[model samples]
Target: GSDGSPQWGTSAEDRDPPGGDRSNHTACPKQRTVHKCELLHVAIVCAGHNASRDVVTLVKSILFHRKNPLHFHFITDSVAHQILQTLFQSWMVPSVHVSFYNADDLKPEVSWIPNKHYSGIYGLMKLTLTKALPSNLSKVIVLDTDITFATDIAELWAVFGKFSEKQVIGLVENQSDWYLGNLWKNHKPWPALGRGFNTGVILLLLDRLRHLGWEQMWRLTAERELMNMLSTSLADQDIFNAVIKQDPSLVYRLPCFWNVQLSDHTRSEQCYTELSDLKVIHWNSPKKLRVKNKHVEFFRNLYLTFLEYDGNLLRRELFGCVRLTVTLPPTLQQALEELDEDDPCYDFRQQHLMQHRIHLFFLQYEFLALPNPTDVTLVAQLSMDRLQMLEAICKHWAGPISLALYMSDAEAQQFLRYAQASEVLSARRNVAYHIVYKEGQFYPINLLRNVALANTQTPYVFLTDIDFLPMYGLYDYLRNSIQQLELPQRKAALIVPAFETLHYRLTFPKSKAELLSMLDMGSLYTFRYHVWPKGHAPTDYAKWRTATVPYRVAWQPDFEPYVVVRRDCPKYDQRFVGFGWNKVSHIMELDAQEYELLVLPNAFMIHMPHAPSFDISKFRLSAGYRGCLQTLREEFHQDLSRRYGAAALKYLTAERSL
Candidate 1:
């Protein structure tokens, strides 16, 4: 069978002799032929009680591209069988057969294959297929559930014909040699650079692997010391690398585009330029299933698009509860099973992603209703350095906005000139740009804030930084909430917290709600507000929402960056000229006036991703910071002394700005 001869010839006329010896391969009809193009056998492992939905999605993606005929044998657990059966039955085609084989049923054969690690045990399920699957399955293309086929899977099956006499498996090479780096210390024969592959995608010669003694490979995994030596972060990947290393001739490396993983993205930029030619995309990273962010959703949506579920009712019926469910292995599955949904440590980011996709589904039809877009004005103070962010901010928001840009020296003015000439300002007529020229590297931020405040004509003003993006329906909701408040409550300052995204890019394709889907809810924390009891602000929107009147602001400081206030509220203290202690001084003044600070429920601005602008060491030594401290003492000391006596001024320099 190792000889370069087709076990089942392509022609319908090819036949084996009647009652011929069938010991070498699985016994089939003695006079039967299989046209390779007409039928294909694809085996996918979804063991360790993983999600059935993802496997269904993978199958749908494969079926979308291939029209001829397909037989997909799924190796999974009993828990997933019912769902898989229900899903595949609905998607069944005339020439396709969807079959499931529980990995537990094959336990007797692989009993010698030690369950050293759960991941390694799960990986061994693929090896058991030769004994577990029907004997007629000689050549099977194995795939991980995380993969989606972009090209017809029949094309991938054809790669089997390209294999040499010695080649027992067909797989794309690993994008990098990072996986093989450990073999250097063991003095083992490592795969050549770019020859190692992620086991996410593989075309296995099941009959040959059986002939080559799959039981012996089982014994190799059972050895404790050897398993420890072979162990990597990815337990199974390391073992597979060693197997291929011992017998490199057994594998035939296909083109890189066949199994493109995240690591493969480092290939020439031309790979993306020629994306249409890509056959398969494997999201082999564990995070791909756990973290449901925009990047992960991008590929998932591509798979879903090809699935092409008809009508909104059908889409909701299928994916309503199934969205964000992942096919996790044993370790993660156990961990997730142990954690409650409401627990502080529990991860619900994926659920948020599902909500966003559902939101996008609704966003397709309904017109966004804004009560009065002209009544409220968004005021932002920014330095000229973040001009692109300013442009993006304006483009994202539909209503009128005011930008107070502090130009620090000639370079900033030059940037302004470039922005003026460019489409940044010209395309958006509702945006009002107010440039304040100053002569230093550190622009006068507090002065800029006051300038922006002075320029706003609206009765209600939302003061925020240039990078913060308001969530969808915020404008309409704010308008309705403001209208509901009593005359005295209307004068209150609406406090909204800012949540930061852990990204560096300034652009987003989706709305703020969609972007919020990417953030881990457990990791979401508010910015530090100095004047709060614990030096970090905590929002209690429940008190404000349920109370008859606006929630009273007694001691809480107003961090003005994401607060909406009446036009007549106290302005930002211009005396505190630089970054530190500027916004809090204004907040302290608002608190001094006893203006109510109502924390709006379920509404907040998202901070666009960006690195800190100032270097800490240099900023501490700068004249701006030095002058800021003196100005802070002079301005805050008087207010602190008058408001709560001279004793309160003790914290003036002792507790510096964060």
Candidate 2:
């Protein structure tokens, strides 16, 4: 064991052999035997808005150098989780699998340990690694989001095998003199061993750490150290070193090349003699690539190479066939079941957190070629049946369209073929299709809307349904109205009057004047005029007929008219899934936020008739479905009251009183 050979463990002989089911095979075979490559497990604690990009570049670097497959455990918040899931799903790298654990789940474990680091609680999440990861995972390589690998990750994974019997972690020594208390006179730092250890890159023997009761050990060390130090300035790193200071045998020292620290005060020269020997580059400073180091340019260039690398080239044959059905994990399913049925939005919240297999930005052939500054983007969601309408919408708008399409695997393949054959859909380059595969019987309409809205790249977004045909030149009219009216400076939504006609063969209206003519002729009626008059009554179509300019409209109950608003407006609530209240809930939220809804005199949208959706049909036929919808509606109003105060719900209260 002292000769540096791998020490599997004291009970290594009791474990099964490396190759599986060797009992049936002869001692030697004629052909060379191929052994399946073991998956390299890696964990990263990535939180905040800007961490997704850094983590993506880090993962790309690992995939570039490692020949074997990888399994990534991302301890992230909701924002980073959604972004990363969309990216990795679309990238479709054959050798990569990603699982996300909510950072909030581990907050209780480290919340007691006060941290002064900018990352705060997220930085301390690493201390709960033994509890955060699955129990089956015995070993994992944990890396900081600010690192890029220059060598195969397998070489780093191999370090775990070299850990001595008493060692539970493998890490590089800190390449700085801050711990020596010599930076300034009377400097005091958290207790640490000689030079301490850098946690930027770690080989965590999770099984061993769990056996050693890591949670209690770290807590005791932190509690004792906090008494004298007041608080930890370096988060998990400080506690890790403190624990090691008590027992040095708990850590195995990794080579300096594995973590070339690039902090402004780093003394890396003492650990490495040449740049060529560096296996990993760690920009451990807040300044990142801009940190002041002797070899800053070299390290910066290495990080940029991975940053600019083409992710498409790293694509390979998918690891497995597309799953026909996506079953919610037991944890998610139990969470959903335990939700208060009376809480209308609980399911919606769960759906947002649910790990559904999504492929984002699936096809965007002309996204990059479009002009940089577009005025408005059409954001909508649809199923495969709506594929035929894209050509017409794209040709009419002739601007940007961020679409979320829900379909099965078979339907997606069919739609791809359909897009290739149609000239309008194929030649146009400004549309982005984000595919959300089928999950359950109910369609996640609001989730689709959020996906489309989130991906819109324009300054303003025209939120509408895919079944509506915009009045000709609507895009230009809205763009000119926005500038002429100065809508951007104010909290406003430019409402486009919507109409519906039963006659499908009639020529679509091109101008507001012609639309009024049809209105007079009794061919087209205001959308849902008879069944759901309140839905569009707030737009005041009677006044819109004579008004020549944009007019402000008061927020009214059940108002869900289509509108053009800023890209950063409040998102649709995912709880109002199925039929009924999805769009109405969003309208209510906008009202609560005090957004002025202004009716545009020139622009309009006409609905094209189509068969009812499955959700709508269920709502009509099943009393249980209708009851659920009513319960959700009440809960949503209560939520709005709580979020924006009772003043925000005055309209609803007034309507009920009437």
Candidate 3:
């Protein structure tokens, strides 16, 4: 039926045999039944964890036994409990992956303190071979997940007869010095079978791994300090070497074509051209293809291409609970049951809440956490809140908010200089104070009001950018205005001092639609972040850049939102932590159906300007960058690459209009 080959396609279903259900993402092949998948199933055990998840997933799906290609699994102790198991029942996990096993379960024959680490891992590897390996498996190859097959594994199996029948095996020779031992004759070897080998690519025989002295040899060797296991006493591999050298009849030294060891990959991001000629590609420490943001982004896109239920599953994992089932050994199960359900947790809720929110966007600053409220400073929100009526219309958008403070650090000499240079703010009688500094804040409207409720003692403290200028002197005008009201009784957070700006960004056309758009009639600001193009003022790098930000006038609510505080008020809730300040916006959540906005008439202000430069491509919505990816999308779950480096996008949505 087919005229071409799907050389690059990795879908297990596409390759599954005839009469098998190929409808589901899971392919059930009726052909190739002679091999039975359960037999060809291979598991790779790794002591290192830089790469495993996604790579293994692709290999498993592609090489999975439709008629039984092989069900490949990777074992490691590094997986976190909440990562894959907690998110989905779909079974396939994200990242370079393999089936998991904890090295902590391996027990030592002699009673010495057993670690849950490297030494413990050898025991687990032995246990896996002793317990699960199928009896009929001609030779079970335990390889590193970094392995990429140059050719189909059938070729590797074809050569099995080349070596005498055996269960455990490894690549025979090494061209490099073993990190564990020196190969030169100057070094003495007591039990080592021969020179040490690179542990990266191993072809394991379950029976040979379960040989008479394997566990004993590993235990005696691992008992001493790990450093002592050099040439004189090799760890797991050393034991294998000793055993193999004594009995080459049990193990065969395969040629370089079988297991190729790579020297360095850090210099480049890729190297498969030379590798294409290999049968089983073994990645020793896979640095280039390790799982990270790219891996997450790949899976994120797959949801749209492959699964119809993508978003639903994401929401469920984020907001709901997942069920997990594990088959533990009888003794292990009993030990876990003895402990109370909550005994291991000191305060699970608190830790979970904090850890979960760390990934949310609004958590990277101190202002968002409301660290201090008593450090009294004027709080001003540079946002659109004109008439009280318009202010009420803009309260519905739930977006992020950011806060910043402007503190003028002036010396006693500068205070004297400022009095003559700018008369807008001057020394008051009996206010004998040397200029330590004058301070202020720019908060989102929600936080501005919150800070005001706590800072009532500062009689003259109010919200206004330095742009708040008036003929009567900006500070005097505000101080006089606050004195006229009963501060405690009315409790107005801030006396409104919104000023009109003199500068804005002129819009240029990138496209016809946005180019024709104009600033609304009588509205202020076209571009944002611009400094006073004409002022020689106190300059901070932060202050200097505040000018020249792009701004546009659009439909926004306006309300008389001012700064108010009682000096003892708590810090503001910092849910908003980036930009955008909508006035009287926080109060709308309360029932401020209609509150009149008091405008400072005939006044003007210019927001500090900063130029805009952005590159949107940096935030690609790939699997590794999107929301969490624990399991593969069931729809495209079948399309895993042999190397599983990239997700293949399968669906394209045409423009609804075009």
- Would you estimate the TM-scores of all the predictions? 0.39, 0.55, 0.36
Given candidate 3, what's the lDDT at residue 371?
A: 20
Candidate 2 has an lDDT of 0.80
> Per-residue lDDT tens digits of candidate 3, residues 97-187?
2345554443232224333333343423533454544555445555544555544454454334344445356554543345324556565
The prediction achieving the highest TM-score against the true structure is 2
Please give the CA lDDT of all the candidate structures: 0.57, 0.80, 0.33
- The parts of candidate 1 lying over 4 Å away from their true place are 1-37, 48-50, 107-120, 182-195, 221-232, 263-273, 289-301, 307-658
| Candidate order by decreasing TM-score | 2, 1, 3
Rank candidates by lDDT, best first.
2, 1, 3
Pick the lDDT winner.
Answer: 2
Candidates 1 and 2 compared: the better one by lDDT is: 2
Look at candidate 1 and give me any clashing residue pairs: 174-196
**What would the per-residue lDDT of candidate 1 be over residues 179-227, giving only the tens digit for each residue?**
5465456544233334466677788888887888855763464353254
Better of 2 and 3 by lDDT: 2
Worst 10 residues of 3 by lDDT: 355-364
Cα error, residue 638 of model 1, in Å, equals 91
**Quality of model 1 by C-alpha lDDT:** 0.57
Clashes of 2: 1
